[model samples]
Target: MESEMIVIHAENAPMPGISKPGPHQRYRHPVISVEKRRLGALHADEIRVQMIYAGLCGTDVHLMESDPQTGYIRSSAPANIPETGRVIGHEGIGKVLAVGKNVRHLSEGAVVTFESIIVCHYCDVCRKGQFNQCRNAKLLGLEKDGIFGKVVDVPAMLAHDVTPIIQTDQDLQAIACVEPAGVAYVACRNTRVTGGDVVVIFGGGPIGVFAAMLCKTIFGASSVSIVEPVSFRRSFAAQWADHVYDVEAFFANMPECIDVVIEASGDLQNINRIFRNVNANGRIALLARSGTSLVLDAMDHMITNAISIIGSRGHLCGAFNDIISLYKQGRLPLHQVVTHILDGTDGFMRLVGAIDSVLYENCKVLIRFASANGRS
Candidate 1:
């Protein structure tokens, strides 16, 4: 049955008449329109989903404000806006309404969430169980259609049945956040944050906050400190971090006692300073994505101290299940990360406004679909 659905489409071209901004400033906001479009047919391995809630991610914002001249987004990978534009969202949860004949795991009326990366199982990396690094992976919302609309067709393999763990509306909300939370989980897991470790996170954004929370509540870190320049973010992170410091205050009171460092902020100026703060044999995990070249002057410090630096990319397949398990156990308070929930009926302008206010006013913003209240 063909039906019309509302979708948020990101335009490939820049917004008319807006000049590009200086570095670190917002670029010409990409042209996004909320319009009704006909739904496509479901493939044999796909399932039809009715989106309930979708989280706004940093990648989405980068794609929306892509470089005007190149039309490229600076994120985990460099991607140019497709000529036909694209649907712009990845983190979300929904209810399954129909399953294709080839689908076996999920069923109708099942609540579910999805992994953003669609990997080819035949790839060499996938054969070795490193599906996250699959050579031919396609990122949803960027390389293909995303789940920003009221209804979407998702590959059954990429959808996880989260119905068992969702006991409340809040649980449903937290499940929508599993994607970003998984990124933080992988960072902390790779760094091996354990008991007695004094960890420090360089950014207090959603990822940094999640890392800090895991360090203290899940990973057993003795002390977790967060450094952020935004006062609102610092205040928000104080609940999870043992201490929160503004960039100036953090440098002024620099202590060489950290056992692990997680760089969630893409600010390159702190590269050298991070080496100085860690104790000997400390581990550092880089979680942020940046297009600019990073310059460091603390090579000697890193070598002499035996510090290991690790670069973490996207989350693995297991991360989503692990996060869902944690949430089921009540160990993860993922709901706290959501600061704003805008109704989709407000349209594209409201979403753009919410994105603009993120730097100062919001932590995690969600768009609730108008049909969310009526489930199959």
Candidate 2:
């Protein structure tokens, strides 16, 4: 049986009064209508992706609940997307089904992936190689149409060469997590963590686990400690970290302080406690999403201890290469971090509406979609 066609909004396009779309909008924004309108028209750079797998991200949940009243609008759309409605799936990986004119990088069956941060190349930030912060950044799945559907046309430039890293269609599918993993990879890289050290990490979410895992695989930290209150998440995160304890337990743990602190959890209280555990002259990279707020004793910490805090937004898809290298070397265990695989529609909706603790006990949850031409 064929599924109903869906009509989705282009990226960054707010529905009149709504500043941002939420889970309700998923039911409201019909991708079927858009497909019906251009039933047969060729999308210029469209290479209908058979969404093998896409990971569930925290930002996706926030966007699902976003209140338009409180949401802020950007000044312009991304440059690469001359057209306004770009599909947003920064964590998407799939096979290229059909290609438009002049698109040479991909082929019909090549398994590929990319980060969803599509930027307006003309923006100053983009010109400075900071495309993630481009004045006109239209993130995949955030600003435009996302990869939750069976068929989505992504901007050509936004797509990366995933041929070498993605081996099987299944592996290509799990690569959806590559985007956020790239985030952890980039955050750690920015810290330039090379020497042996002890690391403290906050949050036990997927990103938190990835951060801890890399601390083991990439930096080979002597001791890794994670601060998390959730029992399941803590137990799950403990598999990777040397010691996983309650967030409140931080005051008691005695390790003489850590060399680095990676704050993956967006909770302000966790952020505050993380500062207390970091050794003077240590580095802390903040990798939470937008709208997360924290009031820290900067003068006390910075002046007294000389701590360096680096704020990172949007992972450079470049980390996909690094993640790929780690996977090939058999250094990182991606299977532990990835969980649940659902058919696109159900998975997409469940992630939006019913993501409670019990649901996300698994490390990663992925969604699979059909080919653009409506073929599996």
Candidate 3:
């Protein structure tokens, strides 16, 4: 007999007041519904997990607002839209309930979190040890059934057993967020931030905040600053960065002083101006995904100054383990980053409302399952 479980489902629908794609075409919001799904037999290389907590990501919001014409999430490439609505979410932690016969490393009752990108090991990029950029990579929430369900069967190789490092409920919360924080970790690593380097990060979202935290604690940067337009986010960023400034305040006095710039905000409008703030021989890492084309008119200046711009994608496979180690050492103060934790049992609309309202005041919102209610 199959067990029934609740899952969040996402599907595309046409935007109101718009008929066809044009210059001002506004994409419709994804039709979200809460439904019960019946689970089938677990695969040989998979482990069944009962989710405890799941983080709401910007990518989730993007997937919820996919382009009507292409059926793809706007600004993101190589993602397919399933003909039927799909379960949505990737960043989460859970307890293992059962393990496949072939899964030797993990067993029942182990605490685990997953690598969101399911890579095809035979791909050329995977053979080159660039698994994150696998040509045949399938994103968990985007291309397959994801962890939004109460129970999910995950590939054994993709599951990271965090049971050893989890000392407190806070640790579990941080582990749930490891997927996004790992992205920030890769961003900082890709830029090669060293001790004494002065860094400025654009945007004060969770990834931006994580980058700032890693720059200070792990990389030993001399100073880290955050430039964000939202006052609420600025307040949150102030806890991790040396200085937090609104857009105008940042530009007035800090031009040409930064050694590194990490762009975590996908705000293309102000991206061009950030080039003017980097000192000669400086580096910038872009971590955001946007559909719009970036127009950089500062190519001449960039060439003359010897500045480098790097594009960073998802986290490398090792990043998850590295972040888990940092958490074990208690070096990462992740408690400050999670601003809201809502009840997953509250149903689908509450989750949707939280996602909709995250822009104004929330930073790193999480949904807690019933099992996690009294733990910590």
- Cα error, residue 371 of model 2, in Å, equals 9.6
The digit string of per-residue lDDT tens for model 2 on 1-376 reads 1222222342434456756643333222222122322325447776666666667676554433434563332212222222334343457776776777868887777766767776788977788887667787767765666665565666676677666765555555546677877788887876666658888877788888888888887877888888877787888888898899986676576477778878877666565655666778888888774444577765686668888888876766367778877776778767567666666565455544455633346666766665423355
- Candidate 3 residue lDDT tens string, 202-249: 899999999999999999999999999988999978989999999889
Query: In model 1, where do residues sit more than 4 Å from their true spots?
Result: 1-29, 66-80, 345-348, 370-376
- Model 1 scores a TM of 0.89
TM-score to true structure, per model = 0.89, 0.80, 0.89
Task: Please give the range of 10 consecutive residues that has the lowest summed lDDT in model 2.
Answer: 73-82
Residue range 1-376, candidate 1, lDDT tens digits: 5432333333344445648622223223356766555666779899998888888888777655655565544453434345455666788899998999999899999989988888999988999998878899888886777888778888888899998887777887899999989999999988999999999899998899999988999999998999998889999889999999999898888666889889988886776766777898999888787755567788888899899888877777599989889988989999999988877636445767556677677788887873445442
Candidate that beats the other on TM-score, 1 or 2, i.e. the better one: 1
What's the true lDDT of residue 117 in model 2? Answer: 78
lDDT of each: 0.79, 0.64, 0.78
> Any runs in candidate 3 off by more than 4 Å, and if so which?
1-29, 66-78, 345-348, 372-376
- Candidate 3, run of 10 with poorest lDDT: 21-30
Query: What's the true lDDT of residue 247 in model 2?
Result: 66
